[model samples]
Target: MDLLKKKIQDEGKVLSESVLKVDSFLNHQIDPILMQKIGEEFAARFADAGITKILTIESSGIAPATMTGLVLGVPVIFARKRKSLTLTDHLYSAEVYSFTKKETSEISVSKDFITSDDVVLMMDDFLANGQAALGLLSIAEQAKAKVAGVGIVIEKGFQNGSSQIRERGFNVESLAIIESLADGQVTFKEEVVSR
Candidate 1:
């Protein structure tokens, strides 16, 4: 996680007060070695939950989620933000608001991918208002699947979303949490694991 924090510090950019873009290494062009490390760490953390599947949203979350699935040897299911023609009515759905995009959208997963016996590990690239995680959790609920835990790459700790998710009694782990981004600087939570 120290490596990840350092990567963000070295290459991440703040697009606004709410969006921290890591398009160089995370949200866009990816570094697979680093991604594999991240996947290993996450797998180690949630290894006892008996996870049967990895769930994530489209675009950004796919990389880490897929990495996690590969490491765990489980299937990775990505919820599509943009519905396609091949989608069927047998899908579990939830509406999530994107604080970055400044709008709400529906994220859905095929019912065949998740089932009642599944213990889902939800992963996302960022956690701000918790909308994306909430939507994924909603889908898990609808499927009657148990949420094993949630893993986040970067969490804006100053935001209310992390607290809301914690209040739900789910195990939440974030690699780097920014306490503040004041004065054109990124101030992260001091509890970061030492390298």
Candidate 2:
């Protein structure tokens, strides 16, 4: 995970006190090798969780989730934000509010993809306020699926997101935990802050 932290340090842009843009090599433009390594790491961490499926939200979470699925030899299911004509019925849905986008979206997944017999692992590119993770958890609840754990690629540890998930009695593994993004500086959770 040091490689990922280093990548963020090298290319990540702290746009504001709460916003860090990593579109250069993560969400927008992806590094396949890095993504593969991320997948391997996640697989290793959750190798004993009896994971049957990988769940992620649309757009940003796809790449990392797909790679994790590939490495774990499991199918990845991404919740679609936009509604499609075919995604009309037998779906598990939840209301998710995006902290970065400042918007709410109804994320849905097909019931055919998930079941009560499956153990799901929620994966995301980033975790801020835990809204998206909560949404996925809601969907999993509706499906009566067991949650393996939550895998976050880059977590804003300064936020209450990770704590919220932990409070719910689920394991959360974040590869790169950013303690703060203040004054246009990136601070990892491991580094002590005097202030």
Candidate 3:
């Protein structure tokens, strides 16, 4: 996790009081080594969960989730932001409003990949408004699956997302938790937030 926090310190850009863009190495252009470390960290954190599958949203979350799935030896399932022609039926869907993009998108997952017997571990690049996490949780709920927990690469600790998910009794493990992104500076949380 120290490596991840350092990466954020070095490459992350603070666009506003609320937005810290880490697209350089996390989302748009990925660093395989960093992602592998992230995978190892997540796997270590959730090692006792008995996870059967990993669920994440498309685009940003794929890289980290896939890496996590690889480490945990579980299948990864990503919810598509836009439904394709090949994916026409038996989909579990939910609306996720992005605070960063300022848009509400419907994310969907196929029922074929998930079932009630599975223990799901959800992962995401960031946790801001709790929408993406909630959407993934909803999809897992639709499948009647037991969620092991959520794994976040970067958590905006100033935001309500972490508390919201925790209020529902879901464990959240974030590699780097930013306490503030104010005045063009990135401030990480001084205290540890345990799962």
* Per-residue C-alpha lDDT of model 1 across residues 1-195, encoded as one tens digit per residue: 789989988998877666678889998799999899899888888888899999999888888888888888899999988533345599998888876677778889999899999999999999989999999999999999999989998999989888999899898989889988776677789894533
Best by TM-score: 3
lDDT of each: 0.88, 0.91, 0.91
Model 2 / residue 89 / CA error / Å? 1.9
RMSD of each: 2.2, 3.5, 2.0
Sorted by lDDT (best first), the order is: 3, 2, 1
Off by over 4 Å in 3: 83-88, 193-195
TM-score order of candidates, best first?
A: 3, 2, 1
Residue-wise lDDT of candidate 2 within 96-163, one digit each (tens)? 87766777778899999999999999999999899999999999999999999899999999899999
Angstrom error of the Cα, residue 107, model 3: value is: 0.7
Better of 1 and 2 by lDDT: 2
Per-residue lDDT for 1-195 in model 3, tens only?
A: 789998999999999998888989998999998999999999999999999999998889999999999999999998889633345578998888876687788899888999999999999999988999999999999999999999999999999999999999999988899999989999999856565
Model 2: runs farther than 4 Å from truth?
Answer: 83-88, 191-195
lDDT, residue 15, candidate 2: 90
* Model 3 lDDT, full chain set: 0.91
Clashes of each: 0, 0, 0
